[model samples]
Target: MMNRNFNRRKKFIFFLPVAVLIVAVLGYVVMFLWNWILPEVAHAGKLNYWQALGLLVLCRLLFGNFNKGGGHNGFRERARGMRAKWDSMNEEERAKFKEEYKRRCGGWGHHRNKE
Candidate 1:
């Protein structure tokens, strides 16, 4: 019984390092493939390890959302920002912005008032 327990513990120790190695290797391969297979814009100027990590964090902050069942939330945020800036403008500027936004985005980004 003691021998069996010792063997089990030994196997557990071996398995622990193996599992960690597997994870590390997978991470390395994924990072390598990301750098090798993808373009620069996809990485957001993240060529090295630290750069990739930093860019990942910054990009997540600038545009990180999984909503509306699609990957277009960044565009939504841009639209919202444009709307808020337009609304904060003076009447003349707002009118001009409305025209431009309407021309560019079909007025879906601007708020319309109804009588």
Candidate 2:
């Protein structure tokens, strides 16, 4: 299995420039799209390369993840834990848990018999 704690610094060294180029291309695309469509449609002003780059950074900061590992925020880890617990549960335990969850969450026609 691949090491989960692989050397991040080494990976960054290999991928940093590629990542930068990708971001630059994305910024250019944003600038092109905005210039192409927005001005005529919404009377928006045009953006220079620097402005586009700034906008890209701003959007990333506002709506995207700037953190390392793309900001998974422990979701993958939590999911793995949940999956493991679910897999370990026996059929009866699983059924009981499911019914309890439905009861707590308000069953949506789950109380009705299936035809």
Candidate 3:
């Protein structure tokens, strides 16, 4: 079992870069294909570069994780708010949380319980 695990790790180490390169190449090919298809299929109303850029931005706005007001953006905003809550806590609350954390965690790096 150990030998098999070692061989699997070695195989992954050797193949991971190759897999990434293949994925990158495939993405470029797909992009080129999309560009080719768009102009050909919509000959009556060809989308210019800015139009394509706008579509890409819109798609990203709708589907991407970083768009504001939702998704990762909202997640990030919530995280920031949480952080602010932590930061804005009065000294008593901060001290209490520290006490609770220390009591639960047995003091960050120390193994022994406070006696």
Clashing pairs in 3: none
Per-model TM against the reference: 0.36, 0.49, 0.34
Q: Which is the better candidate, 2 or 3, if ranked by TM-score? A: 2
Tens-digit lDDT track for model 1 on 7-106? 9999999999997676566556656767777766475332665555555456657766324634465677899998888778899987887687666666
What range of 10 consecutive residues in model 2 has the weakest lDDT sum?
Answer: 106-115
lDDT of each: 0.68, 0.85, 0.70
lDDT of 2 by residue, 6-99 (tens): 7776698879999989889988999999999999999999998889999978877776676775656788899999999999999999999998
C-alpha lDDT of candidate 3 relative to the true structure? 0.70
Off by over 4 Å in 2: 1-25, 40-45, 66-69, 103-115
Per-residue lDDT of model 3, residues 1-115, tens digit only: 9999999999999899997676566555545656778668876355445555556557667877433554554677789998999999999999998888777778557785657
Ranking by lDDT: 2, 3, 1
Residue 35, candidate 3: alpha-carbon lDDT? 73
